[model samples]
Target: MREGFITYKGRNIVFTDYHTHTNNSFDSKAIMMETCQKALENGVEQICFTEHFTLNPNIPTYGHMKWEKYREDIQTCQEAFKNQPLHILKGIELCEPHKYTEEYKQLFQKEHIDFILGSVHNIKDIGLRKTLAKYSRLEAYDLYFKEMLLLVEKADIDCLAHFDLIKRYSKEAFSQDDFEKFEPLIKKILSKAIERGIGIEINTSTVEALQEPMPSHYILTLYRELGGRILTIGSDSHYSEHIGRGIKEAYALAKECGFTEVSIFENRCATFVSI
Candidate 1:
């Protein structure tokens, strides 16, 4: 077992990382087996492969993921770990889910997907980096959150990933105070998510690159204040070396924000594990 896991209700809580990618994802170089092994080595008992699945033509990873091949790889990994300590789930992290309702409707019919993560990686058909250069810093942030609100309402997703992704590339520096401007919209998104039984993801990849989680501590506090409790922590690791990275910190932040349990999904059904 991984050491230093947080204890709640007189038991140690093992975290499940729900957002991950493998070589099937266009931008990732991590092999599926290697990623799984890394997660197991880190003592992550449950790991979901939420690979990038996008319909946006402009996305570099748009047509890269082949459903059958990806499914086959996951099946192989599942068989390899069947009697092992880790639980592997098939998941997809879809970009701009609000834009392709019909496509997703058809895709899921044949896919054995367990969990889906909705993300807004573009604005007006442009990718994040270009979009940031196209608009003012604050405008870009507004655009990102505005679309997120729409995504929560329109997409059939299990959770929202990387809540404030726009900040990842903004030229202008930002801080928690800037989050105030979008609080109302974010609250609306959270309300819609709760109403729809969708959860929010705490992506920990940002901890190494930005020294903060995508949603940041302020946003999490706001989520708790709004009575939002369904949360999932993800490393968002694109490589084996980074798998399960920063997840413990993410879980600790969740606990600090008044969350007692963290969410995990199996065959699209969400269950809570005490933090």
Candidate 2:
């Protein structure tokens, strides 16, 4: 199980896991309200239910959710937890924005989504998990970083989820040399993310599950060097036990990266909370 903590800012901020999946996502097994209820019990002030939104033509689960049903589930959770201290926000973890822009836009237009996390789970017909398993470690790292740049260049979403998630499965392939090789692409993505007013997520779930942080120190340093300021911290928890995991470490890393403010999104606009 993963541990949780209060943020460094001392806002009584509680913990907010912005990236989470429920049964709405094909790969997740937890139900929507059950996850939100767990957040409440864990003292998480806010939780964003960002179920997966895949667009790969080869995947049977692509476009698995109906917006109407998703909206209904969110509404049910809201009403059920209204008097509770926890605030649940509707969100989606978009996989490969270049392939599903229209579908994403339509969902955003119709739903009162508080946040949207852009993720590159699929690249050139390769899913992150599959890519790591099928290719050499260095090869997969290169592909992941390259596609991450592509995602940033093409998507205009709130924040980038698990910026170094490919490493979760390819840790054995990572090294100072690999980081150096991908530094340019990392910097490029951060620069573009800044230009587009998008925030990057300090995904703590990676640390909890993979034993290594996302946007590892090297990438975080590169982001700071490129004047990337906006950042959001998320646990990316799929189950109750993982809620609020590693959030304090995420905040500490952000501060170490010279970020004075952490970002939160509402109505698709970012609000910064000073650390």
Candidate 3:
């Protein structure tokens, strides 16, 4: 088991990482059950298998799992680890909500998903990673924010994942001025998210690996200022070693933002943990 980030209320808080990818996600290499086993071995009390669910036809890396096969694999994993102390919750990481809202609703209605993470990984038909490689950093950031606003308003999902993930791959340095330019749009997205009862995620994986936490400090502060209450933290770990890597820092940041608690989901309901 990995010994990491045990601080919370002066006690060891065993975390349930809610954003994880397995082979079911096209770009992931680890199998579902293997990922769960690693989590259990790493002292993770619980985890959600939030594999990618994408609708960008241009990106073949978009999820390719059939519903029947996906469910079968999840059930198989659940049963394989049933005797363990760790809990595995069924989840999906939704990408490009504006383009795939109907598909998402259909998938959710057709299956039993314990958690859903809404993310904007694309601007129109292009993936963020690809966009960063081809366009100017400012151009990519603007498109990302614009598309994110659309996702916040249109997607029917639980939590917004890595609110400013596009900035993670930027070729240029981000500044306070850049954040200032996007502040109004950020507030609007947060306001709509609050109105829709959608939760925001403090994705630690961004900082742990990508070197920039999503939503950035300014955006997170704005969310708090707008009276937003529900917030969840995720490692967004694609590999076992990265699980729970920066959660302690995220919790500290949340506390500084005036958040008294962090959120977790089970059976489609949110439960709070004191920060």
Each model's C-alpha lDDT?
0.84, 0.75, 0.76
Ranking by TM-score: 1, 2, 3
lDDT of 1 by residue, 96-197 (tens): 999998899798887878889999888777888888888887788888888999999899888899998888887777677777887888888888888887
Candidate 3 local lDDT, 1-275, one digit each (tens) = 01112222222345667788877777777777777777776667667878887766676656486667778988897899887877778888877767777876786677888788888776667778888887777777778888888888888888899888877776666565776787887888899988887889888876745565776777888999899888887778877666666776887888888898876666566666776
Q: Put down candidate 2 lDDT per residue, 1-275, tens digits, no spaces.
A: 01122232324454567888887888877888778877776767878888887656676458677778888999999899887777778878878886666776675676677788888776677777889788888788788888877888777588898888777766474565776876677777788888877778888866755566777877777888888877878888777677777877777888888888777666676666776
The number of the candidate with the highest lDDT is 1
TM-score of each: 0.93, 0.88, 0.87
Best by TM-score: 1
Question: How does model 1 fare in lDDT?
Answer: 0.84
Q: Which runs of model 1 end up more than 4 angstroms from their true locations?
A: 1-13
